[model samples]
Target: MTAMGKVRGYNAGAMLLHWAIALAIILQIAGGFAMMHTQIIPDALRFTTFQWHKTIGLLVLALTLARIAWRLLNPPPAHAPMSRVESGLAHLVHFLFYLLMLAVPLAGWLVVSVSPTAIPTLLAMSPDLPWPHLPLPAAWKGEGVSDLAGTMHAVLAYSTLGLLVLHVAGAIKHSAIDREPSFSRMMPLGRLPRQSTAFLAVPLAAGLAVAFFGGGLAAGRLGPESTSLAVNAAPGESAPAATGASAWTIDKTASSIRYEVAFSGNPIGGTLGRWDAAIAFDPAKPTEGSAKVTVDAASIDVEDAFVKSNVPGPDGFDVAAHPTVTLSVDRFEAAANGFVGHGTMNVKDKIVPLYLPFIFTESDGRAHVTASVVLDRLVLGLGLQNDSTAQWLGKDVTVKLDLFATRAGAASPQS
Candidate 1:
């Protein structure tokens, strides 16, 4: 074989970093896509994998920058003459590869930066870059910045994947057909025999380790806050009745009903706002009360763009046709905990029954009610793949409600 190109061989440090970053990027891709396809994977593990992906990605960028600086300091030998087409393709491919190397992570960074919700920094977990949770003037949460960033991230990810596949094909073509050490010379370690064990063992172990640690960090460190949510109400002066006749008169000023949804491993969750509801209750007979609420199907919001897009959007509700989601009380029974209520939720064009276990308290003539309910998104035809059930649209959507009631004489609370 011709003497190895003087510029060809990568040093040990550069080679190690390259392999490590490549392995990490590959595993992250697999893990990420796998998580998207399979809901069975614990969310904590998914998060952990993402954290590691970010961490390693930052490391890759740092090393690549250093390599660029080093290349500038010590120039390499010139390439041999080649055909015009070969030269053009070589240059184009190399340029595209470099762009992917930088673009994928930067795109991801932008997506995270514009995230509408705050990402908690856990103890012992240091961020490689500045957290972008804080809102800038006139451009805060609910703005379209994150959506744009997210689209860019997805675009770059696919671009990178295409480039990666081409890179592998080019390497194999050069190594075998050209009978040159074009690919081998750059190997930090010397070329391996066909079907070498090192090729199998090293990459696999490293990927598993990274995935495990990444998943663990996300699950352990970045988990949701463990605190009960409470909404304070304006005080009242009169005494509450004890004849099991207390009824809740919801605030009329409230144009929206707000609550946050949290799951064991999900960093992203549902946020509901501006539910259109009408309360019908007998002021004198508090025990007899009912509520008719219609939530805008398009009003659902999520912190993560990926999760938001994955969630069935307006099509799930067809808010254009039926802009409102209605809920009507079916049954209410007093229990030691508070009140157990059953209601029929009308979403999209379908109605499903939901049960809510809640606590109702009457203080100084005012009634406060708080409850939680879990319902299937499938009944609403959410996450349907050709009308078949899929777990990607989790079967259960947990809803939390905290409504403050007042006498009819008071103005409705601004929702």
Candidate 2:
């Protein structure tokens, strides 16, 4: 095309980007509403739905930037002959669509960046392609910043709905009401007049788009791989050491330690992934020696992602500063159904009295044990700082232990 040539309709690149971004925005709006109102959706699908929402949102951001860059290099066809007021409204709505299309995703990213959960963003829901959070400090992840960003994200998203309606109405007026070839301008099968695209506009506009969004993502890579959320855990190879040897050797594969609490009237539970126990009690004697159970505070694995993140948070376990929670029992008393173990448990630097009522059944050389204990979160310094009233998080946490063990040695060596 010569310099004197005038563009008709949009170039191939511009049209492709325009439709791609439009489709993404529609998915994003629908997904946004679904994710926010998760109570209506099944529990198992909520996490996948959120990941898809983020994936599509970032897709919209990328395509929007590409569309802006393409529009710069290849200007659209001149507006169909229309009144001044009509053209002004079209330009205004188009400009806003571009603005919100970029701003909405950025705000959503902001919400994630400052979220106390510090949940990572994985592109295309692929764990391998992790998108870094903005290099914002972990200390800035307060409720205030998170709430503000969340509010902005939702507000901008709904605002785009208004702009979308206006844009489509304008296009329909020209195509149906005025009988102009407006929709064909962006249609893939439609033919357009020869258009001159400025190769010169490519470098400058594309450079800005890359520098702004790409550079930000690059800076994210330079920062922490992920937000800290105040969680610090020793490597998996490291575990707490037991104090005294026990008569029974634990079968780690068949043993589990679980904790449960109520969240918003729903039961939420998690397991202590790493733990060790030293027991000297004999099932035949019912109560004889001491027992110690040490838990890796960092090994908390909550079923809910949101609740999982908070477990290591300052208001929860504060795993960063307190790495382990230990419970030790020196005496056990025979009971009607089982036995009662009197102990003291330490959590978040707070030592509190702990009691576990357990049933023990032994046949041959193998023993089976089941224990359950209910503890007040406030007494153990758990969630006291975050929710003293237990409005959302329950005040009581119930811990249950089920384990299979084998008697390690003979009862007495008199051979």
Candidate 3:
């Protein structure tokens, strides 16, 4: 039998495709919203959803194209001719659906192409296919392409949802009121009427699996490498001088490391400020130096509701009072991938010992540092869990620091 419905309508092939694409679209919609709304889903789950959305979007576009081609080749079963108003409405609706089906992915593709976020090529696959961005050899200069694409994608999503609702409502009206075999137009063939729950269950199960697994893979292990940029060590010259080489003065002009903080229950999340942390080292000796950092706490512009509400940074690292958080490095060690330094992180009225594993690269007599630290929030008394609602906020807060400090002056180790 043909893939479209049975007699006088679409056969099984077309029907199955229709249902499959419908399931994919629904999964994409749900997953997209879920990921946007909360971080509850682990990274793996988040990645999977993103990949699934991309995959399903592409599938919808392909299936729509195939359906169109099939119609051209074999033609849709003739429907009872409608009045002028009905014909116009039907035509407009079908056109809009097709337009959206094609446009949604195109917008997404554009967004991904220009964005630093890598795009996945195959559905449910780990390998990513990098596509070129809009700057066309740096000619189409500006961030405008990426911005426009993202906005268009959001707009198309909502518009398509509305269209889908209208389409379903129209189908139900035709089936119930007109007693038209409209639903049958896309029904499978030879499948006994009122088939067991598997019809719905199988697709539903497959969809859920795909959504979960795909998102997990994408966000978790299977996805591409994290889109993190870093600065590495470059060639440099140094001399052995008494009292060690002079300290590299902190360079405020250099790009400051930036991070985005997310708490489980925090209502707000945004960019934290940049700071200049200088490092002193002996190029000739390699391992002889320290790191000094002074952060302008007042400049820390965060949007996390929890942090905002907890005046003085939970542990009273109050910017209004102290205005700065300082870090003075003691010693450094070379690691397999990078370097590590044991130091003290000083905040308002407290000096906490910290062992920071950091990456250091030297170029032009300057060092760049990118350090990742997961600190026990309880130690700093960032008592984020005050109420029942804040209970979800975990005790460990992950702090990732990426900084570039220039060579300033050197001082003897204070024993």
Candidate 4:
């Protein structure tokens, strides 16, 4: 067949692939922006959105590759008559669109691969269906590499948007203004009425406006907020004095430290199976009390054996490297219900200021103290960054302690 006859229009397979990939890309863009921009999304919803976005991105990458292979094997239809420069510009735009479709998803994949948070990309939450791991250079296994890849992903995605606008505008112009057959070439059912094309353009423009402006507004309103609290002294600095306090011995059998956080939209509780504390306090003189506590990071137990074992690994606690977490409080201020202590916490090689509020009751030389505090996991370098992974695993961790103590050289407190 002659070139014009052979290339009269895209084959059935080409047209099917075109619409399939186009629809997937549109959904991916919408989901990506919505998930990234919206603040305070319920954890489960946010996780589901991210999973869909990642899955769709992978699908787009696969479909684009297949489309390219098909296009190369079977040449596209001959272009409608136009100026040489116009044709060249159209070809250049088409080429860039394809290039960006490939680049954008690969960049996104790289961002997920090197993320310090280390969330796995599982297909439909099935461990057996995870995306193939992409090997990283030794230097690329850090936040810096992830940040660079994230930037590239954003840039390429915007570039793809720009090219899409141009491509769509050219098609609309050819169909509605110039009254040409250009737009019909790839249409499975051939040319539509000019009125139908105009109707389609109206909704297309509205969708674009919503995606751009609505997304920007959501991001501005819902993005992460500053949660920094004031600290009296920097980490490792001298703490206030707590003298004139009687030393107390902690009753190991009755003392416990527990933490609670939201996981998969449910409240999950855990405990530090092994920990110790040294306390010196006098209920009569609250300001003269001090306490030091140490936690064995490897002993974190969340009820699930698999999760329990993994929590101590590099991506979670890195307990092998930083085996212990410690907190020392030497200053206390009386509160309406209890006393508040100012201190510093050392974990994962990062020291951060900590505040503890507790209620203390004493009877017959024995004391029972109940304390609680909320810590921003990120500040302590607890392997949770401000990325999607961190969002899935909530930011604030609530630590609660119950201690039974007695004056030094005294017997254990009677129940």
* The best candidate in terms of lDDT: 2
lDDT of 4 by residue, 1-415 (tens): 1123233566665677779888888777767777777765665787767766877787677667767666665657675566687788899998997898889888998897787655556545443344533566757867898899988988888777788898898878766765666667778775332211223433343454345334433442333210111111212222232233488877778888889876656567888777767776766676887878877776666642213324666656777677777888878878899888888898877888888889988888888899889888767666454343564565678998988888777787553
Best by TM-score: 2
- What are the lDDT figures for the candidates, one per model? 0.53, 0.74, 0.55, 0.68
**Tens-place lDDT digits, model 3, residues 2-120:** 32232266545456656876777777666776777777777545545665677677667666665554444444565444457765776788789778877887787677556422232
Judging by TM-score, tell me the better candidate of 1 and 2: 2
lDDT of 2 by residue, 51-135 (tens): 7788788777766776777776677778567789998998989889889998999999899888765556766655334567766
Write the number of the candidate with greater lDDT, choosing between 2 and 4.
2
lDDT of 1 by residue, 295-404 (tens): 65556555543334323333345445565667777466666777666678777778888666777665655666677777766676754532234322346666777776
Q: Against the true structure, what is each candidate's TM-score? A: 0.47, 0.72, 0.47, 0.56
Superposed by TM-score, candidate 1 places the C-alpha of residue 408 at a distance from the truth, in angstroms, of 1.0
Give the RMSD in angstroms, all C-alphas superposed, for model 1. Answer: 12.3
TM-score of 3: 0.47
By descending TM-score, how would the candidates be arranged? 2, 4, 1, 3
* Ranked candidates (lDDT, high to low): 2, 4, 3, 1
